[model samples]
Target: MAIRVYEEQGIFHLQSKGTSYIMQIVNGYPAHVYWGKQLAFEEQPHSFVDLPEGPLFLLDRLPQEYPQYGTGDFRSPAYQVRLGDGSRITELVYSAYRILKGKPQLEGLPAVYCETENEGETLELELRDAYSGLIVTLSYSVFEDSAAIARSVRIDNQGEQPLQLLRALSASIDMPRSDLDAVYLAGTWNREAHVQRRPLGPGGTTIESRRGASGHLLNPFLALAAPDADEDHGDVFGFSFVYSGNFFISAEVEPFRTTRVGIGINPFDFSWQLAPGEAFQTPEAVLVYSSAGFGEMSRTYHRLYRTRLCRGVHRDRVRPILVNNWEATYFSFTEEKIEDIAKAGAELGIELFVLDDGWFGRREDDHSSLGDWTPNPSKLPGGLTNLAKRVNDLGVQFGLWFEPEMISPDSDLYRSHPDWCLHVEGRRRTEFRWQLILDYSRQDVRDYIYDNLSEIFSTVPISYVKWDMNRNMTEIGSATAGPEQQAEIAHRYMLGLYELLERLTTRFPNILFESCASGGGRFDPGMLYYMPQTWTSDDTDAVERVKIQYGTSFVYPVSAMGAHVSAVPNHQVGRVTSLQMRGDVAMSGNFGYEMDLTRFSDEEKDLAKAQIKRYKEIRSLVQQGDMYRLVSPFAGHEAAWMFVSEDRSEALAYYFKVLAEPNAPQRKLRLKGLDPDKLYKVEESGLVMRGDRLMAIGIGIPAELKDYYSYSVRLKIID
Candidate 1:
């Protein structure tokens, strides 16, 4: 990574492994010059300010690095502030700049990091509003091995009086042309991360989440791709906000055909009271550019996130093949029943047994006992310690689930602290799943939770924890906050959560944490920083999962997805699929099972045993290897993908057909990411084929297969 500057011409050029970003100072303002394929630094880079146009027209047309409101730019501004005199218009001019050898951490927020300072470089540009004494610093960090640039903004109030910020975005960019289509992920509840693409309109196309979460309805990810971009060929630019709270991303096309894209915290119902000498830092935004297509773009993110973004011991280790009891016995399982399932799972080579919900308080259902963390003596007979030891004695590790962020009205904790939840006086507090959101913004609330959880972790031999949030925020008012600080509740809540997680994760470094917002609702980069993995979705049916998991791969790596094989008739969609298909889909991610193993028939038991054993043999490759997409499930009824080891010595390919066709012609599956000069042997067919021929000519599909049929082939290098 390198940051080049031409002091005389006021040009800054940042170069990553395969891309470049250049900006220039024009009339005391930072003007965006180019951002694409790498180019040598030139003292006289092309300038938009030098175009032949009127003074007003030039200001409107020039590509700005960080545009401001009321600055003659019609497009959306990166930030907006109100002064003490009630004036909103402000213009910031470039004042100074500093370059650093490494990236700086965002205060109280999660961001991507490098292991060594030499792995990346950062450039900070300071702009100042002399009249108002407002300083905005734009930061850009480029990595040595990845083609991704991390961007964020820091606002400092240097005047004597307080200032209110109406909008503070993380990053913005202006593309030279408006010839790309918007590609994003959108869905809801049981269905999450469904890929959607559309052409850019004349005005702005915005996607946001106001639910105080990176909602299940819209993910904080946006990609602008060429009109004809496919999996393997075309230019694609991706913008992912590294935040788990409410956020907005927009793509606006101007009259001159230039597209301006902006992403950051949702500016609706959001404001920050910046006191003098105080600073506000926006969350980081990751920008990726890929000229080879969407597939390459995804691979770049996978490698970076798996190595640098996710921390802890589990970051490099293969995830455990565990079984959760949520689907087996939801809120109604006894101690004896759990032990029986644990024994059966141990017999089938399962590594961990997760006892989910109903083990605490008088919590027979979701309506009560959320905030109370004490285990129920009636179900366990011998406390959590005895139950956990019994499960461990059965040859499987123990895991537990908790919804610490929710408070049920009928619980003891709520009764004791009546004002602990988010609420507005005389207004109704909306409850989803019969639980209210805890006001995490308060220090007392966080301390209560931290102390309680610390006690449990220290006492129990828990090897894993499933952190879940079952609902969104409503009536987002903090009881302890004054009127001036009321609007900061949402942002403050996120900050509090980060602090809590940091403390817990550090205290218990050995325990693996998996985050879940009712499954896939809060699955963003911010959560991934604390918890390495996330439950992919609530719907576990193999057929539905094919599409769900496929869409999720657009930005997330396989190691970060928690996939499990559930019962035959799926709980969410009631779709019955074959065990083979379910196992095949689940093996692509952190492999596991969520159904009752004791209830399995003799044949099913044998099949599951074989599946677990096979997964153990290739788990490392699937979890750590590079992935290639051969066919898209969104475009047709068939889906195919493959994982190749970093050394190109081992490969695993899977193909699935949702519905079978009668009298269908023969077809071959093409493979990707292979060495063309090497020869390989296919384990399934027991035949040898050249790598080039196998990838070029492909392999044939089984002739007589039924509905929901799936196939997998393992390839190993042959001398």
Candidate 2:
């Protein structure tokens, strides 16, 4: 693959493979720089310069020469400069001579360095732990079309021994003022749950910019106005921006090790580590230029996001509408109870029956009886195979739940193999809700889970698997491994789970899987690779879900979101809402119902039936349409969204005015993604409106009919 860089419209474009891996960077906006051709070391400038004022020391001092391999160390390589204007770009740089002597610290010894520069944007990528015979390569490029966007980096390792290296990518930017707007997306980690945007200064605050065992530094800008910097954890304002526009970072070892890519309002600072013959990559973070402040930025963010990431294939095969027993039954339900719920759901046209937790083992709640894998006799007396047959006989597919990488301290599996859990031999194992994480890193542990899970699939004719991970890593220490091996636990744990899921899906391709972590905890592309759909949130109250789903849809399509109409008062939020309103919200995505249908009143049941029927009719269009965001939930007092299918033949629009002003009257809303040349028929009056007229006049509709009230419009393409 050829690496090429060019400039267009004041933007720098980098391309690989003739035009593949394109990335763009706008002039004056800090850019991403990488060196070391294919499998070479790479680097980027850090966000800020906050080194301690002593002698600036190079990482670990290496002797001038090492005797084992050659005259020069493999870590050191040729350095080249590509300068333009006042930019002295260090295209590539490598450190000199070192060898791994099989010692604990030097087993993976050779360390290489690479650097890049674009105007003020610069970074350095390093490859350490080379002595272990690991081959490391880093890749980078800029887009030819738009320089404001940077191409993603890829780290590939070709080595024999596992190596651990700290890989950091950093960048710096010049902001107009200390009051800069910044946003970042992050997954749920125990202590690193929040992202704080604070001033760095003698006049600013320096909080932990990056967390985890790997240490980092954050220096604030020196302020002229304030003398002392104030700091608070929850003071960050930009959840909507971070959730939708932010980047998700992760590391992969074995084939690839770890990654650290930086994001900054000023510059970039990130890094990673790798084992011999491993690789790692960072998720792409799309940045937009907006002077309209956070609200306008958020609006455009959602709009562009819908046009890009949210579009997907429409399945016309008619997916079964499923009802999960988790929210309804939790861990306390019998076979008769599930059958009753299944029967009720079937009457309402629900096509899938999912039995949740407590079906397995003699467990009653989350605290005990994990890893046993046996069906609880009290709740599932007829055995899972028989239960599956009965549910299948009801004309609905059967599904079950599993938390494979977890064990209860009081469970049989833990008692028999205490070493199976993640813990240090002498250190106390951390417990969350009476549960401990299974040490899937071991082949024995992995095999055990694989065997049990495979058996369940073989024994039962289940059509779905709801994979759940309820807790994050805490007190991360492993018992079976030595101290050097403990740090590898977290990454290995995830890999083990990935391997297990991959096997399960490959073996049972027809069975659909839904990933759930509390609610949206582990909702990332990594998990989506195996499970197409994910439960959006445990909070199903329509009002709260509007924002949650809106934020989620920016990076994910509606088809991938699991939305259900739960009865009010909601279990999480004790507010009672209208059943019609709930259905209206739920219909916009993958539709389902979580509440007990038998508990619904006659009128409510009728409404449920009607809503299900409506969804069935439009599900095709919803699944295969181009989503448009006209008004953002984080912007105005109202929230509005629309979806138009390819060819512009069909469209579904929804607008909700949360709080209406006194005489706001009707608001004129412009519809998007419509073919201006085609004629269309509005469903309500059978009135025909040409696409031009619809686009020109737009739709004049009331902004607020009532609190939580909504209006929907449907359009059909006419030749």
Scored by Cα lDDT, where does model 2 land? 0.53
- What lDDT tens digits, residue by residue, belong to model 1 across residues 1-719? 79998877788999997999988898888988888878876656555347554444556788888899996787899899988999888799999999998788888899999888999999999999998889999999999999999999999999888999999999988888898899999999878999999999799999899999998999999999999898888999999999999999999999999999999999999999999999999999999989889999899888888888899988999989999999999988899999999999999999999999899989998889999999987888798989999999988999999999999998999999979999998899888888998999999999999999999999999999999999999999999999988889999999999999999999999999999998999999999999999999999999888888889899999999999999977999888889999999999999999999999999999999999999999999999999998888899888999999999999999999998888899979989888989989999989888889989999888875688888999999997
lDDT of 2 by residue, 1-719 (tens): 22332323211223211122222232121222321112321243222212233354211112110001222222221111111222212221222212111111101111011121221121112333233333222222222222222222334445453433233221211221333323322223211112223223222222222221111111111111111311111111121111111122211111111111223211112223455455654222333332223333333333333332222222233445878776787777888888888888888889888887888777898778988989998887899998888888888889888888789988899999988987767777878878888887677898899899899888889888888777656666566666655755654555566677767777888788887766676554445556767777778887777766666654455666778888678888786767776887788888888867767778887888888888899886675566776676666567777888867888888876666577676686667778888888989668688777776787867454467667778998887
User: How do the predictions measure up, each by TM-score?
Assistant: 0.99, 0.69
List residue ranges in candidate 1 displaced over 4 A. Answer: 43-49, 52-57
Cα deviation of 76, candidate 2, in Å = 22
